[model samples]
Structures are given as C-alpha cells and as structure tokens.
Target: MRAGRKYFIYDVFTQRPLDGNPLAVVIDSEGLDTAAMQAIAREFNLSETAFVLPPKNPTHKACVRIFTPDYEMPFAGHPTVGTAIALSEMAEGNDLAGIFVLEENIGLVRCAIDKLNNGLFAEFDVPQLPEQLPLSADPEAIGAALGLGPHEIGFENHRVSLWSAGVPYIAVPVADLKAAAKVKLNNDAWVEFSPRKSEFAVASAYVYGRETVDHTSSFHARMIVPGNPSYEDPATGSAAAAFAGAIMRFDQPTDGSHRFWIEQGIEMGRPSRIRLEIDVAGGKLAAARIGGHAVRVAEGVLLA
Candidate 1:
C-alpha cells in the first residue's frame, strides 16, 4: 500500500473558518491514480477536492486536479484559490507575493497571491473567456425544473442562458431574492428539461437574483447540481467565471474595469462572498478575474 498522504481542509471565499465553501486539498498526490483521487474526493464528501501534483512544466508551480464527489472537473474556482493559499502557507517565511501558474485540465492558470490582514488572498484570471452556448431549455421548462413558475424564472433583460468559462452552467435570473430562494430542483423535470443530448447535459443550474443580503453585494446566487450529495453548493467560482459574459451581455457596462460582489449559500447557513472583476474595452469583454480569501481549518493525513 502507498504511504499516507497529507491533506488540508479549508474554508474558501471567507475570512473566518466554516463560513465559505469547504475544500479538501490532498498534498503529495504524485502516486495516486485517477480512481484513487476520485475516491478520496468522495471520501471528503465536500463540494470539491483538489489533488496537487508536480507541474509538467518547470516554470509552473504545480498541477492541480479537481474532483467533485461524482466526476473530475477541468477547472474550478475555489480549488484554485484555496490551493494557492495553502501552498503559500506551506512556504511560509518566503515571499508569497507573486504570480504562480497552476496547471489544470483547461490550461495553465496564472494566480496572484498576496499577504492580507486576515489571511492569504489569491486571485486568478479566468483560463478562458466565457462563451455563450445555444440555450436549449426555455423559461417554462427551466422554471418547471426549478419548481418555479415561468414568471419567476427571468427578470428584466436577463433570462435563461447557457455559458461556460471552463465548465458549463445554465444561468437563470429571477425577479427577486425570494424567487431565487424558492428554487428546488425537481430531478425528473430537470432530466426532461435538460437531456443528455442537450448542450447543458452536464451543467448545473445557477439561479441568481439582483437582490442581495449585503448591500455591497450586487447579486444573490445559488448553484444546484442534480446529483451532488450536497444538493446546493455554498460558493461557486467557476459559475461566477462564466457569469462575466452574462454581465457584459446584459449590463452593457462602459469600457473599463468593473467589480461586483456575489453572495451565496445563505440558506445553507454557510454564507460565502465571491469577488468578480471584468475588464471591458470598446464594449467587448477583454478579461475576467475571480478573487477570494481562504482560511485553513484543519489538517490530517489520508490513509489509503
């Protein structure tokens, strides 16, 4: 049997412990296979788990593999941010302020780290710009899937749209926070609404509303994956990455750098705040970045 591997648990996207999304980072995953990694991720039973491996490129710091309880992800936001902070802390006493490239399935992601008053702060540029996918589910079908009426499925110019930065998600805008909170996934309806042959076959529905708990927050969001043990994700950086396109397409922001705060997981009692920044030039999206704080909560060894 292989020797025990060390793993750290982190609460990401929040300053305090137990407030943000929980992540398990397995260090020294050099010898583990894909099946083992997937099992470890399922063992942790969090929204997502990360496996840190040696970088294929000499210049990159590390290659990270992200796995949900069900499947491996090409790229994920919390794992990227949390892994950077964890590695920075592991290299404590060294200069942590700089750019580090993390090799992911999507590509090499450039992450910036800095020492903060609360803890370590990490932000990474979206590996790919959000691309719009053809909408396959209509408002009525989407509403039925989410146990909402057609009227509650969309607000203003915002409607149901499919997008992806690295992973795909169906973005559904609601009229108010109450409407967003009322969403409950009807699995049967969802399967019918988004079939396996559809473009959004493996996508989650990201329901959001303009109203937020925090006045500083621009929106309140919730993500529900049909088969995850945790029915609702506390925080979702990948979804936010794709949301940049929806913001640009609908808000029509002027040419400049714009920042927005998204509040999520309030109902689950693990409130998480995500910082999203978008750069626009001549009314076109130039870049997108996601930033957040992660606090180390626990550390242990995994015996497999």
Candidate 2:
C-alpha cells in the first residue's frame, strides 16, 4: 500500500454537495503505477477518478490522468473542472480568477477559474473540435439498446449521430424530456448493436431533448454507459463536448457565440447543470467551451 497519498471528493456541475456527479481526485500521483491508479479508481467507485501529477511542461498547471473503473480516458469534463478548482483552492495567495492549463491524454486543456456566488466555477475550451464519425448504428438497434421504441428515437431533423471531441459518444435526440428520462440500456441489445470489436466500444449513448427541467436550460440530457460502475452518469462533459457537432449540424446556429445550458441526471435524482458555449464564424465552428460549478464534499488520504 502506498501511504500518505491525499485525495479529495467533489460534486461536479452543481453547487451543492452530492447533487451532481461525484469525482475522486488523488492530489499527487507521482509514484503510483497504472495498475495502482486503476485500483484506486475502483476503490473510489465513482463514475471517474483523476490522478493529478506535475506537468511535463513548465507552463501547464498539472497533468491529469482520468480513469473510469474499467479504462483510462484521454479526457473527461467533470474531472477536469473539479481538479482545476481543487488546485486553485490549494494555491496560496492566488487570485480567484485566473487561467490554468492541464495536460490530459487528448492534449493540453486551458481552464479558467472564477469564484461565483454559488461556488468556484471552472470552464475549459474543448481541447479538440468535435467531428462527426462515419459510423452509425440502426435506429432500431439503438432504440433497442436504450429500451426505447423506434418512434421515440429521434426528433425533428436530429437523428442518431456519432461524434467525438476527445472521447466518443452516440448523440441521440429524443422526442421529449419524458422519453429521455425513461431510457434503460439493454446489455444484450447494446452488445449486438455496438460490438466490442467495433468503434462503438468506447462510445456511450447520450440522449437529450429540447425540453428541460430548468426553463433557462436549452436542453435536457442523460448518458448511459451500460457496463460502467455508475451505469448512468449524472453529468457527462465529454458527451456535451461532442454534442456541439450535433448542434451545428441540426440547429445550424448563425455566426456568433452561442451559450447553451443543459440539465442532466434528473432521472437518477442527481440533477446537474452544464454550460456549453459554441463560437461560430464564417459558418464554421471556431471553438467550443464547457463550464460548470463544483463543491468539495470530503478529503482523505489513501492508505493504499
């Protein structure tokens, strides 16, 4: 067991504790091997756990390794936000507002931190521009995997689309919030629809609708990764990042900076809110950003 390793627990995308997705961050993971880190992630049993290490580049604040119980991710949203806030809080004599760069598997991500009335807020520019993938599964197959009827699968011009910013997800637009809330993944169907050897192995289904719990929100969403420790994630930043491609494709927003508020995790009782900002110029996506609040819940040392 590696003794004296510190960690913090944070509820991400929400101001209050235990309301949003929970993240466990090992403050300094310099000596831990990959297997040890994976063991720590499983021990935490959260949707994702982060290991913070000194940056390889002097200009970056830190390098973060994100892990689900099953695999290491190139990047993840909440962990990035939570880790930044945690680091900022730890820095002595630092102003509340500043920019920090973090190195992740995808690339270097720049995060801006601000102290809001609710809590510390962190927002980061998407490290990679979301791109549409040629891969797609049948609507029927997708519906079956999600326990939805074919009729409820898509809405308006939106259909099933595969997109990735850093991580990939199947963006599924449903008819309404009610339909979005009722989603259940059938493991067998999902395996059949998205085979293990296929590209969808790393992809999860992200269902969303225009209707939202908060009137100020632009969309309501839910994500289900069938075999993960947390089958349904309360909030998914990566999915929201990929969703920018879907928005540009279906909504066709005019040239300008557009802000979208997304409500997610209501069905699981862990309601979370995510802010997505997209900048367009010359009818092309110039950049995108994801932001939200996080509150520290607990802190402890890992005996192992």
Candidate 3:
C-alpha cells in the first residue's frame, strides 16, 4: 500500500466545530494533477476542497486549487478563509498572526489572518468587485423556482438580480425569514431561467431576506447550486460576493466602509456566518472583502 498524503478538515465561517461549512484541505498535493484532485474532492464530498501547491512565485505563500465534487472553481470564499487559517496555523503557532498572499486560479489573493480568543479568523480582498449581469426573467418566474409566490418574492425595494464577482449568482430577494425558510429550489426550473454570462452556463440561486434568525446578522441567506448534482450550500462566500452588487444597487450605501454579517446554512443544520465588507467611493464599489473564522476539526492521511 502507498503511504498517504496529509489532509485536514476545517469548519469554516464559525468559531465552533460542526457548525460551519466543512472544507477538506490536502496539504501534500504537489504532484497530483487536476483529475486526481477532483477525485479526492469527490471522495471528501464536501461543498468544496482545497489543494495546496507550491507557489509559482517564491514570495507568495502557496497556490490553492478549490473544487466542488463536480468541477473546479476559480475562486471561493470559504476555501480562501479555511486555507488561509490552515496555512497560518501551519506556519505560525496559535499565539502569532500572519499576513500572506495565496495564488488562486482567478488571481493572486491577499489574505490577512488574526488569532482571536474564539478561533482563527482570516479575511481576503476579493480579486474582482461585483458586477451586475443582465437578467431577463421577471420576479414571478424567479420566485416560482424558489417555491415562492409573487407576494413573497421581494421586500422593500429589493427584487430579482444577477451579479457576479468571479462565479455568477442570481440574487432572489424574499419577503422574510419565513419566506427564506420555505425555499425549495427546483433544478429543472432553475436551469431554464438561469442567466449566462459570456460563454459559461449555470448561475446558482442565492435567496436572501431582511429578517434574520440571528439578530447580529444583517441578512439571512441560502445558496443552491443547480446542475447534474444539484444541492444546497451551508454557507457561500462567492454568492455573498456576487450579492454585494445587489446590495449596492438597492441599498445605496454612502461612500465609506461598511460591514455586514450574513447568516446562512441554517436550513442544512450547519449554520454559518460570513462577514462582508465593502468600501464605497463616489457611490460605487471601490473594494470588498470576505472574512470568517475557521477551526481545524480533523486531520488524517489520504490513502490512494
């Protein structure tokens, strides 16, 4: 039998274990090709898995490859948070903090790590700011896909919108937490209406409401990926990144730094909280950041 490579599992976007999104990180993964890495991610069967490879430029920390079971991702929020924490913990002990750069597929991601009493928190500047994409489908159609009616579709001025930072998401604004809880994403209906940008296909659904289960959270949210293996995500950073555009469009925050905590994954029992920070300049999105806490819950040898 071949000796296995080292791997770790982290609970991301929450201080406690078994509460947040679980990410599998394979550390000793230099020689493995894309196909093998995809197979390992499928084996772990989490929302996403990260493989750490040596950085092409020696100054950077490492190269991280993120993947869902079905396909590779250019970038993702939880993986960036989890991987940053994992790398920080590996490089420095619990007492010290770190700031480093990770080479992600989208681009070089700048991440900052802080060691706190609850857990280790890591935040990264989103390489790309959110941009709106044209969505032709009306509110009624979008609501139908999420098992909501016209009345339950929107709250305040918020309505259906499509946005993307790197990955695409259709932000469906619902009435309340009650409406958010009732979401049952229909894959066939979703794919039929999902807006495509450029040459890619399949933009996932991100449902949000003003009312939240946690008083600290600014929004209660849910993300559903619709495809051959359609499933709900516990906490989605990328979706939140895309939703930033929708927030800017409707809320119209002034030119300053703002932070909002988004609570997600409650429907799946793996509750998570993601922190989104945006800097507004001249009434436009200047920069944005996604941050969260992570804890290493398990470690093992990956046997082939």
Top-lDDT candidate index: 3
Residue 264, candidate 3: C-alpha displacement in angstroms:
0.4
Score every model by TM-score. 0.95, 0.96, 0.96
Evaluation by lDDT, superior candidate among 2 and 3: 3
The C-alpha local distance difference test score for the whole of candidate 2 amounts to: 0.88
Give lDDT: candidate 1, residue 55.
97
Candidate 1 has its poorest 10 consecutive residues by lDDT at 193-202
Q: If ranked by TM-score, best first, what sequence of candidates would result?
A: 3, 2, 1
Clashing residue pairs in all predictions, respectively, total 0, 1, 0
lDDT of 2 by residue, 1-304 (tens): 5699999999999998889999999987998889999999988989899999999998899999999876788899999999999898888887667998999999999999998775789999999999988765788788877878988988889989888898778888999877897799886667655524223254688899987888999999999886633288999999999999999999999999999999998999999999999999999899999999999999999886
Q: What C-alpha lDDT does candidate 3 achieve relative to the native structure?
A: 0.90
What local lDDT score does residue 127 receive in model 3, on the 0 to 100 scale?
91
Model 2: weakest 10-residue lDDT segment is 193-202
